[model samples]
Target: MRRRDLLLLIGATAGATAMYQAMTRLGFAAESPYRGPITLEGDPKGASVIILGAGLAGMTAAYELARAGYKVQILEYNTRPGGRNWTIRGGDTYTELGGAAQQCLFDDGLYLNPGPWRIPYHHHAILDYCRRFGVALEPFIQLNHNAYLHATEAFGGRPQRIREIKADFEGAIAELLAKATRKGALDEAVSKEDQEILLEALRAQGGLDKDFRYKAGDDAADFRGYARDPGGGLAAAPSNGEPIGLHDLLTSRLWRGLQNFALYDFQTTMFQPVGGMGRIGEAFARQIPKVIRYGAKVTAIQQDDHGVAVVFEDLHGGGSVEEATADWCVCALPLSILSQIDVNVSAPMKAAIDAVPYASVVKTGLQFRRRFWEEDEQIFGGISYTNLPIRQISYPSTGFNAAGKGVLLGGYTWGGPNSYELTAMSPADRIKVALDCGAQIHPQYASEFETGISVAWHRVPFTLGCAGEWTDETRRQHYGNLCQIDGRIVLAGEHASYIPAWQEGAILSALDAITRLHKRILASR
Candidate 1:
């Protein structure tokens, strides 16, 4: 099998943790490259910079440039800051590309982050900024043992606990390995001493009995949970549940869900802002309040050897055309929207802008009358994987065991036919689909659902799609030209960095772009 196929097989059979380990050995997964906060060492001699968009990248560039003594101003299309770093709460209204306006009717304190939800610990730059800006963060639960893994064809379509699948799979594998070792099947491959050590390790890791058997007993119950709970009074002894046979377990294919939590990105210690992901953008905006010009849509980007001029329509001022000039420009607009604008840049740069495509994504936030997932299922904060079109349902990481009214990320569909299918529907129909699909995992979805909202990235007005989607061939052909400083105008955003589709990518790209721009400016003098 090919390496990719091998990894997929491991993920299907063993689990995602094993697959990640194999991938790490094969150089597929890596940590972030952010070192620390950047320092612009030299002055720009009072040079000015024009930053486009009010997203993290634009705001990051503005924040650092203004502190470095450059006169920095940002032109934003939206009335407020945080382009994709947005949050929708009650009383807010959103109009998509097709003029489909949805008013958020969520209860107060219940909101949805339509983009860039979790921040990995390895993403040092964003975390450092959050700390500096006083944006409190809470743990984002990626996996809960009590959460479910559901396959339509598995176990008669009943959901199984993540812990059950994980434990049973591990235990069964250990038993087979032990049987092989006892039969001297590894005599040529392993020394007797090493085999003994391996057996002991497997016994401990798999919660096996002394005979190396993975059967129903205290050892098995310790891992898979007891059939009957141990109480304080008579008949307090816990009863071990019957372990699923290896044949049945393999056929069920529930092990595929194990990969979701084992991937490097979804590992433990992920975090989200206390209020919403939008808090980070709001915090960045707080640092550079006067620098942003809201409701200004850029129509053309023109540049000369002397400076750069950006022509925009004053959205709030009767749509009148206006021009803003600066010594330099940082265009942080998403490529989906930028490719449609008239930009005066080199052929390579323009081609690079048009080369990248945006991903299709749909996220639906459903508010419930009660926290039924917690009250009835004992599932706190975690994700439930399914084979349904909705993909996965993520429970709120905040508000553990709270009383009434909670919001759930009912459905999040990333790329593929499902995302496009959901994108084609009206927002109301999308919500209905979410309710229908999610009900298979949580039956309470229909009754408990109060009101919901959905955001299809393709329909979003400001960003025609989600983050830039770059393929290997596209990156190899155009990534350099995309990041190269085109005269006085340069691009910065998640698309400009290796780590696309992440806020960290946007921050890192902005820092790198500004650092390079600062060097070129000082050299020019």
Candidate 2:
């Protein structure tokens, strides 16, 4: 049987609790940011809560609220859980705002996570939930030494290996600093004792030779890698790769991509769910299946001191308008969609809703005939950065070396005119752009392409656009209003957190919202 069918069979056969226990036994769980289970301390006296959107934030709140003795009911716009935490697999279909539908045609077990993909190790809340739900985790390689970095105008448009550029750049900087320090250029900035320590550190860190020079030699080759790799036999001597000169390396502008690898969030040891990021949502759904009302497009939100009432349309049932009311509400809807709704909040809150704008992102997933990136280019996993419109190409971290076929993130267009340009095109055209732009970095895309699916977040009906884009000025003026509970209702999601566009932001925002809401419940009683 295919892996997809096997996964389905397992899901059908196993209960949520049993599946979690099984995953625990298999060592699928990891250390988490959140401690153990949350304790609400006191009873809610059977309070009722109406949650908006069944995304991570909303579901997270519902899970904790239900456990704390609150009557929780969730209003979700989509037929499935995991709003932006979505995965596209073979046989799945997606329809955008322009009535353009794309059917995924990837092979069994292959998928495209059009939304959030990588999970940083520090995102404690989401990790804790994954541990609790038994969602399996696997390393998401963010910076692979073998990945490519290409600038369309540099090095004749040929790609350079990450290891080569990183090593060369470090070596060049070390040499420059050493030369300056020896010449007394930094006499005022450094003391004699510290200068000696700095020189020693640079020599070791930059892989410099006995003379502290980053030249083509065995020591240099060990760090940046070799032109001819060392083998196991007597004839296995390695040849050194020359360090890229300071001028050429600076002019190439390839060094700009290196900073992302050093970022606190994108650093090594990132993770993804075993199947897909949506497994987190699916697991959350299992805990509270009966509470969610799918296909409920909330049209208006009105809250009085007594309670909150939401007006919505049943999209699945002939678009009949209906109302749901609860003692309190947690609105996790995206600002892109919520801003248009007739929400009767305070003037400051309304302005805050309108103040933020959502970002535009287009992601395309391409299936290839085989794992040519691994076989041909030796790029097993990680992202390749380029100056092209596609921005970056990510190879799958799973199924390395032993693959009949594979899917890669062909293009992940985030913001700017390029994102808008791609968003305007049809789904097929978007895929074509991805193929054309990606060819500049990996020529194999021209021959090995099989099928593709593209998602332009601006054109997605459910989200209208990607996560909320906050500028310093906008956040200064509106962020407080957005997060503060407006009367009997509060808001939570990635938009409400500092770590925007991340699942951790959404989970953490939910936790904060519920904690405050619980306090209000106790104070009111």
| lDDT for each residue of candidate 2 in 385-441, tens digit (9 for 90 to 100) | 998989999999899998689999999989999999999999999999999988888
lDDT of 1 by residue, 368-474 (tens): 99999999999999999988888889999998998999999988999999999999999999999999989988899878989999999999989999999999999
Clashes of each: 0, 1
lDDT comparing candidate 2 with the true structure: 0.91
Measured by lDDT, the strongest candidate is 1
Off by over 4 Å in 2: 1-36
What is the Å distance of residue 495 in model 2 from its true position? 0.7
Off by over 4 Å in 1: 1-31
Best by TM-score: 1
Which ten-residue region of model 1 has the weakest summed lDDT?
Answer: 27-36
Ten-residue region with minimum lDDT total, candidate 2: 25-34
